[model samples]
Target chain A: MSVNTTQKKHKFNVIDAVILVVICAVVAAAAFLLGSRNAQSEQNSVTLEYIVEFRTIRDEFVDNINVGVKLVDASKKYSLGDVVAVTSKTATFIGTDFTSGQLVYGDYPDHSDVQITVRSNAVINDSGRYVIDGGYEMSVGATVYARMPDYTGTGYCTQIKEIKD
Target chain B: MSEKNSAAKASGKKLRLNIIDFLIIVVILGAVAGIALRFGVVEKVVTKSSLSSAYVSFLIQDIQDESANYFVAGDSFYSQTHSAEFGVLQSNIQFLPAEAYINNEVGELLKVYKEDRIDVRGVFLCEGIFTDEGFLLNGTSYIAPGSTVHVLSSTIDVTLTVTEIDAVGAES
Candidate 1:
């Protein structure tokens, strides 16, 4: 009777070990599938392109200012009237600064791309507006170009390159 | 009496189960589910705001392009404002002094796109002289009707109407 009882106990132990192994395998497979799915999601990211035309925004003549720095600054600066053409497949215009959709640069050639750099202000007010402006002097008739590349996931404006033929 | 006593004694053998063990398992499961909900999935769908903005921006661009075509089909200033000196900068639709409002409208259009995180649409210019004799003869210039001569900025969009033609500078 003692031998018989010992044999029964051993059989039960074998079954328990098998069950434990099965459970471990199931858990590990679940984890691996979840991990691979996550990596796939990362690979399937989407990007949207926006064509911004920076035209002349406002024209002002600096009489007393030095020409070298100020003129160079103007080349890098872009405003509302700048014309930007995006070669991307599609574009959407959310909103703009002017009521009329025409961007004005002094007199840039039609095909030149407008370059714009955005600087963020640290102050926050009751009005939730993200005010960005440029720090450069613009000639009366110099034209500028602009295009905005905004990400679909992150609410951020990406860099804009000048459209050169 | 001996059989009855043995049966009673066998029935008295202790068998114990702890409630804490079951509770602990439940708590672990609840925690794992919460984590899955928060970070494991379902957060990748595009938000409504983004989708709407994309549609709106595209719509505005189309409208502006249509308006330019309409202007082109008339006895407008754009028909006469021709010359290489005017530069390609102002060559999209034709520009008449009166059409300056259309040019200015782009600024406001950008503001609308701004809410949706899109960039400003292209700038359409009316190619014409600020003066009748072309900015050199007399200060007064006449723009052909239905031209893109107006200029606008994003700052002014907050208080201005997109179609209003009042902000444009008169022909020089």
Candidate 2:
């Protein structure tokens, strides 16, 4: 019986070895495919970055508030109405049409600086200081803008640091 | 019989190193990595919206106050011939305060202007009542009475007085 078993073992040759190798190769290939598919999907989705800053003012200046924020228009040329609608914020001048503001642009050189006006109905005085409802509300929705000494145009939200009174 | 027992032991070891085991490990690792990336596990996420009304209102006041000062220095142009001109001039005043007040007043005035109901433009006039110190009682130099200024809020109206001009209390 022992001799017969030894002969049978030796008879199991390269064919069996080749089968095992093929199984290992197939498993490795499947693993690689599944992993890569997941990786590709993740990379395809775009991630947007935004920052919101809060400026706390005293009761005296609380009746109204204004803060410069960034808006990223990934889709199209956002209008004032589009910015207001997508941002979920109310504007007192909703009835009017506007493109952008926070800083007014000019028509031509030597002309004059035009004042761009953005309106909101959310203004209210709390005790005395004006408060922004949410930093995200200001930063998200559209492309961002800056409050600078020069012309108003596109800008990014670099930080969310507080503006001390 | 002894040889067959030894062969079975060798086969058991080989099973431990099979492709199935390796595949299971790879799948687990891929799933973990995918979840982390999709949910931004390592990144900070912030959601933005709009500013509150109170902040916007204060900003308007500041803008109105500023425009009141600028109007004093700017050329005296009426709402007719200078309507387009003021739009350009107002655009130049980018201070948040100036923007807010101009936006509010312009919209209101435009509504009236378009309707042709409001003819005599209401300008903000200030009367500075001052005293011994800078702003003492009855010593009105900051604002001149009857001088046209923008009315900010119901409680606050930009008044121009006969007193001397003192730029000390001007809010930045």
Candidate 3:
């Protein structure tokens, strides 16, 4: 019988340790990049105040909106923002006069043109549209439907401004 | 001398090249890759969103005037199929004579009201996201002009067609 003395490479040797180090380095690099990206996103977030104009809304609905009321999208339940201010004016409707074909403006009875100022945290997207809650587009002319605790209405975003960091 | 040279070269290799070492290295690399992936991007998924609601008008036809009384302001209803809270009746129902089409002598259609069949238009506040395609109710049900809906409320159950879709506070 012959004695076998060849060693198997099952032990943790230098190359194995080096490979482990490389693996740790790779994971550390990935973790660093991920943390940097999250920090960048967090830094890019800011509080912005925007004005949404709800036109031809019932005056009764206007009564339900007040300062400090939280607004949300009634469907799918998106938290829009809080009502910071409420202003309104008598609503006017434009119509065509059939006989002379003239344009006319008439009062919308019991209706009011309402403007609501809402403050929300948003991030500046690469396209420059302020994204509220990461998805709601705060661009002007985008139609928005905001719902309060007691009422809901459709409106257009007329203006947006950065209030603070 | 050639055999001695080969032996020296083999001893010079720091780590012996073997299939087992290759597989072990591959497994370690794969585990590292998995760890890298696990720490990346999964936390970035957005879990936040808000609800969207719209004001819609549905037309209920061929119903008695008494059924019109069921859709009063502030009354809530449900979808007949899903049994989910569909919407609340916002305004009182509007009445019109249900129109029927009859061909005349020259094949032109004539419009006439059907006897005893009245049509009503009622506005409802529905929860939905408005897209370019149309309004999506509760993220599943789609509502638009001409879409038929079956609705059941505490006071009434009826089938209706969407006649108009408007957003709350929609401007002219």
User: A42-161 in candidate 2: lDDT tens per residue?
Assistant: 543222223422122122211222233222222221222111111212122222224432343222211121222232211112232211321123333333442211112343333322
Clashes of each: 68, 60, 11
Say which docking band candidate 1 falls in.
incorrect
Off by over 4 Å in 1: A1-18, A30-165, B1-13, B16-172
- Residue range B2-98, candidate 3, lDDT tens digits: 6666666677546666654676677677778776565433322322263476777777877775665566788888888655678888766688887
Better of 2 and 3 by DockQ: 2
Error of 2 at A152 (Å): 20
Model 2: what is its DockQ?
0.03
**Tens digits of lDDT, candidate 2, B30-131:** 779877775545332222231111100111222233244443322332222112111111222223211111234212212112221111212211222332
True contacts kept of each: 0.20, 0.01, 0.00
Select the stronger candidate by lDDT from 1 and 2. Answer: 2
TM-score of 1: 0.19
**Strongest candidate by TM-score:** 3
User: Which candidate model has the greater DockQ, 1 or 2?
Assistant: 1
A89-145 per-residue lDDT for model 3 (tens digits): 977766556656666666666678989999988878778778776467677897876
